[model samples]
Target: MNILNKTILVTGACGYKGTVLVAKLLKAGYKVIAFDIQWFGNHLKPHDNLTVVKGDVRFPATIPFEGTDAIIHLASIANDPCGDLDPKLTWEVSALATMQLADHAVRNGIKHFIYASSGSVYGVKEEENVTEELTLEPLSEYNKTKMVSERVLLSYSDKMVVQIVRPATVCGLSPRMRLDVAVNMLTMQAIKNGKITVFGGEQSRPNIHIDDITDLYMFFLERPNVTGIFNAGFENITIAEIAEILACKTNAEIITTPSNDPRSYRVNSDKLLATGFKPKKSVEIAIGEVIDAYEKGILVDKEEYYNLNWMQKAIL
Candidate 1:
């Protein structure tokens, strides 16, 4: 699939991951239509090939799907806390909207659909390597919505090439920076407060850099034949390990505390790697990038950077 002159429709285009992905699409000579609700604010710069549309993904009729060669679905009530804030809204935007979009793509003769599914869908797995074949035991409304959305999209596999990526907790800098995720949050705490807090430092979590995840989207866009659910996390480390890295880089103190949240899982991206996809960044690199961004004043800890806080004040 030569992406030259092809138009790609990206949902949640102004978001943390979508913002980076949209920019990459435009640079690769693909005409992009970025659709978003703009809950936080639009951070995407004006481009000749980019069309930014302010709209809700819940309303599929409002989506600009005409002349779209592919759809990269990234819109949803992101994270567990925000999804739990309003269960009805989460289901409407995440699951129901995905169903409608897949159906609409089929009707409009769109041949490719790439979905952004979460690695957390394999909730609290005890297995050493959480593979795509593992049973999904989603623990939150957000995870359940992603699981349901994946199933819904897979149903249309016969009609189109469906690529589902179960990416681990994404970290790193973006045009729309997010400071709420584990790596970025702890890094910011170290930079701003000179201390890093680790709640149950032994709990391990898988992570992928924002650049690698967005690059994976471009890889999928070029290879429409690679269709199925594939994990995209490259690094699996403990909370203490991440904190130790940040502490080393910023000369910050590490404070460990007890935590009731024992949920921990390590994702394996062997399947995705087998497809010739190479991840170029790591969790430590993501932390370093965030620290550099803050030191250089390119990023800040804002109220909107925390999804739960912003949604509580504005949306909820």
Candidate 2:
């Protein structure tokens, strides 16, 4: 798409994945407009072509959409527990805001729209391979919001290149690191407490390294023609399997406990791979990198790292 001179607006630019993606965008020489509520604090380093805007996505008019060639919508309440805390707020930020943004994008003549949807939207699938064709059965308010947002964005596909990526639970390090997800959370537990907790270990969940998922966004950004819902997870392993990998790496104890959560499914990214997108990282590599960061003092266990804990204190 020759994005060298193109300007891209990235919502949630201060978030876990957003921070990394924004940085990469700038490094790749694309003009970037970073929009965020800054609920967690902006960790994005200053760049020559970067424009950081503190604004709410609910009001699309407030966002600086002028001269924007594409939109990478990443803003949302994020996670099941945090989304559950305020269902109304989640709907406003996650779903309605997306509708507003897509409408604005169409009006503004922004051609490329890449949405960060959740793999959790296909909630609790019985099939071994949960493809994008499967009917969405969103269980939580968060999942439902993502599902609704996807539908809303898809409705505008004719006007713009609507590329939706249903990414698996992301792991690895970021400027705004999150220890709440499966891989990062268990890795932190093993590193800090010397114990890895496994709840309902048999339930398989798909996972992708943070780098791969972020890279997938850039992939979609460059190829605006390749549009549609595509899963982005590479590893489909159980909770126990993840814990065992961490335990071996950190010599931590594996503690099995009962879990009633029950939400589990393996996401297949075959469609994504067929489009020439290659995943270069794994869960084991993510665990190793996180451990390296912790040991090197680049990362730590903080209140903001856990979304539910921080959101309860900051937003609620």
Candidate 2 residues lying further than 4 Å off, grouped into runs, are: none
The backbone clash count of each candidate, in order, is 0, 0
Give the per-residue lDDT digits (tens) of candidate 2, residues 1-316.
5768899999999999999999999989899999999999999999889999999999988999899999999999998999999999999999999999999999998999999999989878788899989999999999999999999998998899999999998999998999999899999999999998898799888899989999999999989889899999899999999988988899999999999978677888999999999999999999999999999999978999899999889878
- Writing each residue's lDDT as its tens digit, candidate 1 over 30-100 gives 99999999998999999999999999998889999999999999999999999999899999999999999
Q: Output candidate 2 Cα RMSD.
A: 1.1
TM-score, candidate number 1 = 0.98
Sliding window of 10 residues with minimal summed lDDT for model 1: 1-10
- Model 2 scores what on Cα lDDT? 0.93
What is the alpha-carbon lDDT for the whole of candidate 1? 0.93
